[model samples]
Each structure stands twice: as C-alpha cells, then as structure tokens.
Target: MSRRYCLVGNSHLAAPKLAWEGVRAEYPAVRAQFYGATRKQLGELEVKNGAFGAHLRPTSKKVSRAVKRVSGGSDKLKPGSFDAVILFSLGFNFHQAEAIYRTHRTLDFNGSATAEHLVSADCFRAALRSLLEDSLAVKLVRQIRQISDVTIMLSLQPYPSEAILKDGWKGWTTLKAEGDVGLLQETYISAAADIAEAERFDVIYQPVDTLNSEGFTKQDFCENARRLDLAAGDVHPVKNYTHMNADYGERVLQQLFAADAP
Candidate 1:
C-alpha cells in the first residue's frame, strides 16, 4: 500500500506541488496531499478533536479557493493518518532571513573564530528564537503536533531565486543578496534547524547542487522566475516571483523522501 502524506503551506507550496505532479509516477507507493491557504488565512485553521480541519466556509473567496486548490477542501488530517506531514517553506523563510542579511556584516560562524563572528551568531540566535517562538511557523507546528504524531518536517523556504541576483531587481534585499548571501542562508538554516530540533521536528535545507557559489538558487531550477529591468522611471515593475520549476520541486520531494526512509 502507498503511504499517504499531507503537505501544508502557503504560496510557497507551489514548488512541491509542481514537482509531485511531474514525478509521482517514479514513486508508485507514495501518495501526497496538500492543504494551503493565503498567509493571512492560516490562522483560520481550526483544531478539532486533535486533528486539523478546514472549516466549511471561509470569510473570503480567495481563502476558500486556496483551501480547495490542493487537496479538496475537506480532507481532514488526523493523527497517524499518513507516513509524514511536511510543512513546506512557511514561517521562518525570508521574513526572518532578510533581517539578518540587513544587520549581520561578513561574520561567518562556519569560518575561523572572531569576536565579530560571535556577535553575529548571538544576534542570529536571538532572531531565530523570536521567529520560532513568536512567528506563525511555531504556532502552526504547535497545532500539528497536537493533532498528529507522524514524523513532522519543517522545510524552510528556498533562498531568493537567481532572479533576485539579476540587475532587473532593484530591491534592497537583492543588494544584500549580492554580498554574503551564502552565509546569510546558512545562518537562517542553522537557526531554523536548532529550533525545529527543540520542537522534535526535522528540518530540511536546500541541496548544495541546486545552489550557486553565493548560495542563491541556480537559474536552471528557476525557469519561471522573473525580475524587473531598468526603466525610464525609477518604478520597479512587478515581476513573477516564481522560484522553482518542476525539476527543483522534484529534487526537494526526493530529499524529503530520503529523510523519511529508514
């Protein structure tokens, strides 16, 4: 019998969904389901009898649509119903990462010891703690833990796609990406793992082969990614923020499966 898995998240669930559609045939004995809503509607999830269920009707059509978009709107996940529950790219992704990028200067914990490095580590730990304790990520995990005893995986969102590295993106975050993006990514993942472990959940990081030298996702994996180029006006046009194609998502799913295996 195939093992059924429930994956829950926001828009970031796009990659995993895309990948599964393209590669489900390869893993004949594994089935996956998804439950997603816009970030704002996440709090709308209701806990019932120790299981997470989507309410019959949500306040907005968009949230209602999101609930049905992945797995039909009524697939209530109960404890031990599936082999795994993977939370993809929620909570401590860019919101927490960008904070460090803007503050920490060239201080690498992976490098030789230095006072500056220690300070950076300290600052990063505090930020990580805040995100885990106060951010939506932890709250969601808390909800899931109460409802399910299956293996839980908290996967951080992928780093800014290569599109952010292009000249078209004039955002301040892109500037920070150019300098020490790898270190920033590492800091985010390390801190996330620390808190995830404390909660008895597993953490997943991006595979090295998918990353470029600076730690941004490689362009090949970001086929649909878009960015705004220089225009006559200082206006930065809205570009598609897609960061993963089916291939990349497939890689992520494969990794998650590998970790799920004994």
Candidate 2:
C-alpha cells in the first residue's frame, strides 16, 4: 500500500513540496498532501484534535481557503488517516539562536569564575538548550502530539548558511572551539529532541555530510541561496540563505526516508 505523508509548515514547505513531485517519481507508491501558510497568514488557524480547525473571522478567508484546499474541503484534517507527518522548518531557528548568543555577553565572570569557566562549551550548550526548550517551536511539537500519535518528526533546516561559516569574531569567539559553533548547535537540537522525545516525537537535523567543517551548510547544497546583505557598517557577514532548492530538498527527504527505514 502507498504510504501517505502530510506536509505541514509555513513557507518552508515550498521547495519540499516541489521536490516531492520528483520524489514520487522514484518512490511511486508514496503520496503527499501539503498544508501551509506564511506567518502573516497562520494566525487564523488552530490545531484541534489532530487536525487544523479554522478561526473564522471576517479576515479569515485566505486561511479558510488553505485549510479547505489542503484538507479536501473538510473543516479539519482527517484524523488517523495519514501514515506520517513531516513538519519542515517548524523548529528552532538557528539563525535567531546565533543572534541571541551574539547579542548577549553571557560570559562576564565578575571575578568569581575562572577564565576557563567562561569558555566552557557546557555553559554555552546549556544556555542554548534552555533557550530552545522554551521556544514556541518546541511547544508546538508537544501540542501536535496532543492530537496525533502517528510518526511525527520535528525537522530543522541545515544549521546555518555557508556564508556565516567563517564569521567567528563578531563577539563570542572565545566560547567556541576551532571557530566551530556545532557544539552549541547540537545543544539546541538535543534540547528540542528531549522535549519531543517525551511525547514520542522525533527530531531530525540536516545530514552531517551536508555541513562544512564549521558546521554551517555547504555551499554546493545551497543552490537557491542569496546573500544576506546588511546595512552599511553593520556586521552581518553571512552571505547565504538557509532556504534551499528542490534538489537539496530531495536529498533531505531521501535521508529522512532512509532513517525511517527498518
């Protein structure tokens, strides 16, 4: 029997949805349906009992249309019907995590702690983990479990763009090792996984091979990338977008399916 997957996300579903068309060609037995809305448009929808329910208002026509279209005219998703649920870009934003880490001078010792303590990876790891555990993204995974017990995976995009790979001296280089922030990245991912695991949810990160030594995404996989151009004199040095093309999406899905294999 063909396995059915429900693709749910905001704008992140686009490339994956496009890639799924080709993926279906290779794995013809698999089928998928997508439900998506931009953040600006997602406010009018709510999860109710394993499906999306409408928040009908005078301004909710667009959201209503999306739900109806994706749910096959049903007011909510059909329960217990899908074989799996793959939510893309619905987890912690590593970009934001990096920004927060940079903005806060978290290592000030006040002459109490030793210099080595200030640079310990554990401190940075814990800080990032705590931040991720409380994010709405982590909470969403829990909420989704409240409605469905099917295989639910919390998908994170590749850690960050390749452009930021070498930008180690913006502010917090002392806390990192070999200019690699991967330890901190894993901390956030691990914290998110811990939350999801409690609810029987799984979290998957970009394949390790897709990342460069600095733990940023590889440029070859970023075919659809664009530069991050900040204002004059601003310090945003990253030159790539995290959103990828269908080719990269295919690779991601292939890895996901391989992992799901027994």
Candidate 3:
C-alpha cells in the first residue's frame, strides 16, 4: 500500500510546494501530497487549497472548515490514512491581532484616535490571547490528533521580511506590539511542549534562527523598503525568502522521516 502525507495550514504552508518541487526534482520516485490554502490541485492530485489573504481571523469559521475538509468531513479514513501531517500555521493569525485592534479601534481610550494610539500595548496583549483561544494554536492540536498513526509536524513560518514592518522597528513596541511577536513565539514553544507531554507525535521547531542567518530581523523587514508591488505590501515572503522556508521544511522532513524509517 502506498503511504500518504498531508500538508495543511495558511500561506506559510504554501512554501512546501517549492520544497516539494525540489524534492521531486531530486527524488522522482517519492510520492507525496500537499494541501494548502492557495491554488488548488498539485499535478494530478487534487489539493484543497484553503489559504486566503488576511483570512485567518481568530473568530472566523474557516479554521474549522479547513479541518473538516482535511478529515474528509468526519468520514473515517482507513487507519493510517496519512503517514504524516505537516502544519505551517500560526504567525499570520498572530500578526492579525494588531490588524484587528487597529481596525476595531479596540485601544481607543477616547472615541477619536490616531493610528499610533490604535496599536496600544494592552490592546495587543488582549488581541493575542483572544486569537490564541479562538484561532490557531489549539485548533491545530485537535486537528492533528484525529488522524491515526500520523506523525504531526508543527512548524512556524520565518519572521516576515524587513519590508513588512510598519515603521523602521523590528516589530511593534506597545505591549500588544511586542506581544504580537512574543506571544506567537511563546505559543509555538508551548504548543510543542504541550503536545510532547500529551503524546508520542513529532513536533518540529522552525524558528527565526535561519532567517537571522541572513541578518534579517523583524525590525529590518518592517523599516522603510520598497513595497512588494506584486501584492500591495502584504506580508507574504517573496520568492527568494519562500525558497529559504522551503529549505527549512525539507531539512525538517528529512530528519523526521529518516528517523522513522526502519
């Protein structure tokens, strides 16, 4: 019987396509599957691409819908339906916390507020916690456990390119600003810890360390830079950066699968 693996989550998950393309080029015998939120269908295999632009809102029902689609709408697959499941989610929803507060004026002490006042520290923290409970972290854990014998890999996207930052800062400064970055890092670490404590599943850590190797920091990316005219300055990494993410995914997959091989 052929083994199957499923890759799911937001745009960060999309990076694996580049990596998979590389893998296919290097090892044509390997058969794998990828499901992301962007373009649907990979070669002859149909991909349930669920990635949408700024669509990972904590309160959005799409999170659950994505999970359901992957699970075959609760129609039980044969045991070991997926040999592995890789998740590249979290950062976008985390970043969205700030966008949410800014749009809702959640931090406005008075009804009238400036853009600076919209991103207050307290509001950011509140947004982070609210997003955590309602969106990415826990939802991912539950989804992974449902698929039997599946080796689950939870990896985060690299920090956005220096171009994504609003001002010239590495990241936001208010409690909310710092928390947006801090909490997402904490959540990834804590979620890995929680999963390890609870089960035998594999959880891979893809931190900012690799991006740092390029001498890029959150501040560098956020500071003044030419907007990526392609997508109107959305935080998605450009092709070169996406290749970096793909390399990280390839290394993580090799380590995990090699270790598991008998």
In terms of lDDT, the best-performing candidate is: 1
Show how many residue pairs clash in every candidate, following the order shown: 0, 0, 17
User: Which runs in model 2 stand beyond 4 Å of their true positions?
Assistant: 49-59, 66-75, 104-130, 133-136, 165-178, 225-240
Best by TM-score: 1
**TM-score, prediction 1:** 0.78
lDDT of each: 0.64, 0.57, 0.43
**TM-scores, each model vs. reference:** 0.78, 0.72, 0.49
Superior candidate under TM-score, 1 versus 2: 1
Expressed as tens digits, the lDDT of each residue in 71-174 for candidate 3 is: 33531222244666665654423345435534444332232243445555455455555554444434554544553445766554454454344333433343
Clashing pairs in 2: none
lDDT of 2 by residue, 176-262 (tens): 432437544655576667666765767777877778777767766666532111111222223445666566677777877776664
Clashing pairs in 1: none
Superposed Cα deviation of residue 134, candidate 2 (Å): 4.9
Rank list by TM-score = 1, 2, 3
lDDT by residue for model 1 (1-262), tens: 6677888776667677767788889989998878766566765665565224421234556565557755665435453667877887666575565554444544553322322234556766786678656666567777777766678787777766666647465443454535555566666667777788777788877777787776667777777522111111222233434456567778889998887875
